[model samples]
Structure formats: C-alpha cells, structure tokens
Target: MPRIELRTEIKAIKEVVFDLSRSIDLHKISTEHTNETAIAGTTSGLIGMNESVTWRAKHFGIYQNLTSKITEFDRPNYFSDEMVSGAFSEFKHEHHFEDSNDGTLMIDLFDYKSPLGVLGKLADKIFLEKYMTDLLTERNRIVKEYAESDKWKQVLTK
Candidate 1:
C-alpha cells in the first residue's frame, strides 16, 4: 500500500470547507479534465456518513467505475471513505480539517494498493504515485479556490 499525505491551508470557516470537500458537484467540477461523473448514490450535494457514490471516469485512457462509501464522518472535523469496488485492490482516503488562526487547515491521507500484485507495486513506484498525488493536489486547489470566494455558494447553497 502507498500512502500520500497533503496539507492545505484555506482562508475559510472549517464548516464551509468541510462541506465543500464532500460536495459531489464540486468534485465533478474539479475532475472535469478526467470527465468524472457521479452515476449513482448521492450524485449531488454533500455526502454524509454511510453514503456510497459510484463514479465513472476515464483514467490512463481507460474508462473505469469506482464505488466508495463514507465509512467515518465527524462533521467539520474529519471523514474517511474507502473503496467498495474499483480498479484498485484497496483504497482509503481520509479528510481532516482543523481551525487555524488564519482559517482552516485541511489534510488528506490517501492510501491505496493497485491490482496485479507485483506489477501494481511497480506501477506505484514508476508513476502511479505521482499521478495520484497530482490528482489530489488539483482537487485541493479547487477546494481552496471555492472556499476562498463567493463561488462556493454555487455548489454549497441549496
């Protein structure tokens, strides 16, 4: 398994940032380059604990569908989602938020294991880790952008 951790500082309230982090609409926008879409389960709006989402997207030039369920959630503080079924043999992502003097501190812990045993390990070492890191970075950038501006209302407001 490979674990990637990232810390992001956002100038916004923890609650708002937390909500944005779990918003399906925001995720779709952030992953537009990959043409990712929520095809089932909590397709729009904030995803709460125990909710599962199935996403279809093109990755590595191949279309894939991944279903993940939120296994743990503690409003505004932290949440963790684990893969139910997907290309990878295992996957878990934890999102943590804390109040900072300036705003909020968002942390991501992504752990995954690819299929195909040894070949998967090679892939992780060769490029998969970097690719996944980039994807998470892009997602965080979008979250920061939305949390810092009124644009957040577009996805967060009901």
Candidate 2:
C-alpha cells in the first residue's frame, strides 16, 4: 500500500474550507467534465459522521462505480473515507484541516493498495502516484479558486 500525504496552506476559514471540501456538488463543478453521479448514501450533501456513498464516474473514458463509506468525521478538523468497493484492493482517504494564524492548513492523506501485488507497486512507482498527486494538486487549486471567488459563492448561493 502506498500512503500519500500532501499539505497546503489555504487562505480561508476552517468552516469555509470544510464546507467547500465536503461539498460533493462543488467537487462535481470543480472536476467539470467528470461523468460522475452520487448513487447512494449522503452523496450530494455535506458528509457527516458515518455517512457513506457510491459514485459512478468515468475515469479515463472507462465507466466505474465505487462505493466509499465515511469511517470518521470531525467537522472543521478531520474526516476520513474508506473504500467499500472499488478497483483497488483497499483505499482510505483522510482530510485534516487546521486553523493557522494566516489561514487554514490542510492535509490530505491517501492510502491505497492495488490488487496486483508487485505489478501494482511498479505501476505506482512509474506513474500512478505522481499522476494522483498532480490530480490532487489541481483539484486543490480549483477548490481554492472557487472558495475564494465571490462569483462562485453567488452561484452556489443562488
């Protein structure tokens, strides 16, 4: 299993960051062309403690459905989701938020193991890990932009 952790400083409050991060609709908006829909559980709303959801999304043009359950939730601080069913053997994502003097300090911890033992590790070392990291970085940028934009707030509010 490969555990990836990324930290970023966000110029926002904990609540704002948490709200934006927990917003599945906002994620859909940020991802833009992602053909993903919430199929079950607390998919569209703010994910709370023990909430779970299944998502059907097109990844690299291939349609896939993954089910993830919220194993831990502590608003404005930390939350975690564990894969119930998906392509990987096991997957868990933990999001941590801390309020700093300047802004919010966010940390994303992703741990996943592939079904293909040695080959999976090789693939990850070669490209998958970096690709995933890049994806998360881009996603964070989108989130930061949206969260900081008044226009985005207006759109969501309306």
Candidate 3:
C-alpha cells in the first residue's frame, strides 16, 4: 500500500473546507483525471458523520462503481471515508481541518493498494506510483485553489 499525505493552509472558513472536502460535486471540480458521478444517496449536499454514498467513476481508463462509507466525521474538524467495494484492494482517505491564524489548515491522508499482488508492485515501480501521486497532488491543488476563491466564499454564504 502507498500512503500519501498533503497539507495546505487556506484563507477560508473551517466549515467551508470541511464541507467542500465531503462534497461529491466538489470532487468533480477538483480533478480532471477522474470523472466521478454520484449514483446513490445525497450527492450535491453536505455530508455528515456515518453517511454513505455510491459513485461511478472512470480511473486509469477503467470505469468502476465505488461505494464509500464515512468512517469518521466531526464537523469542521475531520472526516474519513473508506471504500466498501471498488477496484482497489484497499482505499481510505482522511481529511482534517484546523482553525489557523490565517484561516484553515487542511490535511489529506490517502492510503490504497493496487489489485494484483506482485504485478501491482511492478506496475507501481514503473509508473503507477508517481502517476497516482501526481493525480492526488493535482486534486489537492485544485481544491485548495477553489476553496480560497471568491466563488467558494459565495458558496459558504449560500
């Protein structure tokens, strides 16, 4: 399994950061590599503790329907989601938010493993590791950008 951790400071409300992190629609806004569509449960609204949802997404040129369960959730503080069923052998992600002097400090922790046992290791060494990391990095960058913008400010006000 590969674990990826990223942290960023954003000039935004903690609630906003937390909310955006759990928003299915915002997931779409944050990445181009993954085309995600919400298929079940509430998709466009705020998600709270213990919420579960299903999404169909295309990744690595393969379409997979993933069902996620919210394992941990604390409003404006932290939340975690784990894949119940999906393409990967294991998938889990945690998002944390803290009140900072400037605004919010956000941290993302991702852990996942490829499907094939030995073959996955080889694939990871060749390109999958870097590719996946880069994709997550881009997702964080885009989310951070969006969260710090006036558009997100408007979203919070609504």
Candidate 4:
C-alpha cells in the first residue's frame, strides 16, 4: 500500500471547503480532464455517510468504473471514503479540515493498494503514486478556487 498525504491552505472557511470537497458536482468539474462522471448512486450534490457513487472515467487510455462509499463523516471536520469496487485492490481517502488564521487548513490522506502484487509496487515507485498525487492536488486546487470566492455558492447552493 502507498500513502500520499497533502496539506493545502485555503482562504475560506472550513464549512465551505468541506461542502465543496464532498460535492458530487464539484468533483465532476475538477475531473473534467478525465471525463469523470458520476454514473449512479448519489450522482449529484453533497455525498453523506454511507452513500456510494459509481464513477465512469477514462484513465490510462481506458474507460473504467469505480464505486466508493462514504464510510465516515463529521461535518466541517473530517470524513473518509473507501472504495467499494475499483481497479485498485483497496483504497481509502480521508479528508481533514482545521481552522487557521488565514482561513482553513485542508488535509488529504490517501492510502491505496494496487493489484498485481510486485508489479503494483513497481508502478507506485515509477509513476502511479505521482499520478494519484497530481490528481488529488488538482482537485484541491479546484476546491480552493471555489471556496475562496463566491463560486462556492454555485456548487453548495444546489
């Protein structure tokens, strides 16, 4: 398993950032490059504890489907989503938020185990880890963008 942790500072309240993080609509916007779309279950709006969403996206030149469910949630503070079925052997993503002088400190802890055993380890060392990191970083950038401005209303108001 590989763990990737990231911290991002945003000039927005934790509540706003939290909502944006779980917003299904915001997720689609952040992953437009991958043509990621919520194909079933909690397809739009904020995803709450126990809710699952199936996403269809193009990755590595192939289309894939992954379903993940919100396993834990604490409003404006922490939450976690674990993969129900996906390409990876298993994966869990934890989101944490804390108030800061500037606004909010957002943290992401992503842990995943790729399939194929040894080959998966090699993939992580070579590029998969970085690829996943980049994807999460971009998503956070978009979250910050929305939270720091009035744009957040567009996603949360619905």
lDDT per residue for candidate 1 within 16-135, as digits (tens), equals: 999999999999999999999999999999999999999999999999999999999999999999999999999999999999998999999999999999999999999999999999
Give model 3's clash tally: 0
Which tens-of-lDDT digit does each residue in 38-100 have in candidate 2? Answer: 888876757777778888888768888888888988887999989999888899989999988
Model 3 TM-score, 2 decimals: 0.87
Q: Tell me how many residue pairs clash in candidate 1.
A: 0
Pairs of residues at least 3 apart in sequence or in different chains that clash in candidate 4: none
TM-score of each: 0.99, 0.89, 0.87, 0.99
Error of 3 at 113 (Å): 2.0
The residue ranges of model 4 lying beyond 4 angstroms of the native Cα positions read none
Tens digit of per-residue lDDT, candidate 3, span 28-135:
676545777778865766666777788887877888898888999888798999988877788899888999999898888888888899998788789877887787
Candidate 4 whole-model C-alpha lDDT, 0 to 1: 0.97
Off by over 4 Å in 2: 151-158
Indicate whether candidate 3 or candidate 4 has the larger TM-score: 4
Which 10 consecutive residues of model 3 have the lowest summed lDDT? 149-158
Off by over 4 Å in 3: 153-158
Q: Each candidate: what lDDT?
A: 0.97, 0.79, 0.79, 0.97
Which residue ranges in model 1 land beyond 4 Å of their true spot? none
Evaluated at residue 117, the lDDT of candidate 1 is: 95
